[model samples]
Target: MIDMDRKLGRWRLRVWGLVINLVANAIALFGIVAVVEGGSPALLIIGATLTVVCVAALAIPPRSDS
Candidate 1:
């Protein structure tokens, strides 16, 4: 049972990491495109918000399963 919990926790971390990576990549891509294509204010705002979220995700420590 403890082993299963550890495995599950690892899996969850992997999934969360993947999700964060994908979101960050998507935001960066959009920012690049927006710069090259003369992006609007809305796109800029969205990009800023996503950047904050990504920063927060990295800054906050995850809770341990213990």
Candidate 2:
């Protein structure tokens, strides 16, 4: 039973990490395009901030068993 829960928790973390990676990549691409098009610096800053958050999230491990 505990093993099953641990497996499920690991799966959840993997999925969340994938999502964060996707979002971070998309935001980075958009920021690059925006910069080329003379868009606001604020957008680029926000994208960078989000990327940092994603990286941090990926670095953190999931919670242990209750």
Candidate 3:
């Protein structure tokens, strides 16, 4: 039972990580497009900041509770 619970927890974590990464990439893409299309600089700044933050988040290793 405990093993099953651990597996589920890990699966959930992976799914969330994938989702976060996808969203971050989408934001970065939008930012690039906006800049190319002469959109606001603020949009680029916000998107770049979020992308950096997301990259930092993904760079951290998951904690092992062993």
Candidate 4:
């Protein structure tokens, strides 16, 4: 039972991570479009930074108390 619970938790974490990464990628794409259209580069910087952070976070697995 405990193992099943752990598996479920990990699955939930992966889904959330995937969702966050998708949003970050969308932001980065928007930033790229803005830059190409002559908009400020700040959005690109923000999006890239966020994307990097998210990727880094996704690399780390959740710690188990057991």
Candidate 5:
């Protein structure tokens, strides 16, 4: 029973994590597009860099502090 509960908790965590990640990626992509539209080379570069970082984070497994 305890094992089943643990499995359920892990599944929930993964689902929530995926939802949060997608939201974050959407925000980052929006920022990147906005920056590009603004027509500033330096800001566009910065935005692209941040977008890459955000995308890279999706591949990383989240750490548990427990």
Candidate 6:
């Protein structure tokens, strides 16, 4: 029973992490588009850099065991 609970908790954490990453990625994409529409190369570059950082951060798994 305890093992099952632990597994469920891990699954929940993974799902939540995925959801957060997805939202962050979508926002970053939209930011890039907005920057392009506004005709600012600087903003576009910054947005793209931030998006890459955000996605990289999301891709990295936590160190501590659940």
My TM-score estimates for the predictions, one after another, are 0.44, 0.59, 0.58, 0.65, 0.43, 0.45
Best by lDDT: 4
lDDT of 6 by residue, 1-66 (tens): 122112354474445545666665666677678776885556455556666655555565554553
| lDDT winner between candidates 2 and 5 | 2
lDDT of each: 0.58, 0.67, 0.63, 0.71, 0.53, 0.56
Per-residue lDDT of 32-66 in model 3, one digit per residue for the tens?
A: 88889988666667767777766666565555653
RMSD of 3: 5.8
Per-residue lDDT of candidate 4, residues 9-46 (tens digit): 54765566667778888888899999999998887888
Backbone clash tally for model 6?
0
Error of 1 at 47 (Å): 2.8
- Overlapping backbone residue pairs in candidate 4 total 0
- Model 4 misplaced regions, further than 4 Å: 1-11, 62-66
**How does residue 54 of candidate 5 score in lDDT?**
48
Judged by whole-model lDDT over C-alpha atoms, candidate 2 comes out at 0.67
Most accurate candidate by TM-score: 4
How would you encode candidate 5's per-residue C-alpha lDDT over 1-66 as one tens digit per residue? 011112344474445445666665566566677766875455445555655654554455545532
- Candidates in descending lDDT order: 4, 2, 3, 1, 6, 5
What is candidate 2's lDDT per residue for 1-66, written digit by digit as tens?
Answer: 112223345476556666777887787788889899998666677778888876766666655653
Where is model 1 poorest over a 10-residue stretch in terms of lDDT?
Answer: 1-10
Clashing pairs in 1: none
Expressed as tens digits, the lDDT of each residue in 1-66 for candidate 1 is 122222444475435644675676677677778878987656556656776665555555544654
Candidate 6, superposed: residue stretches over 4 Å from native: 1-11, 39-66
| Runs in model 2 lying further than 4 Å from the true structure | 1-11, 61-66
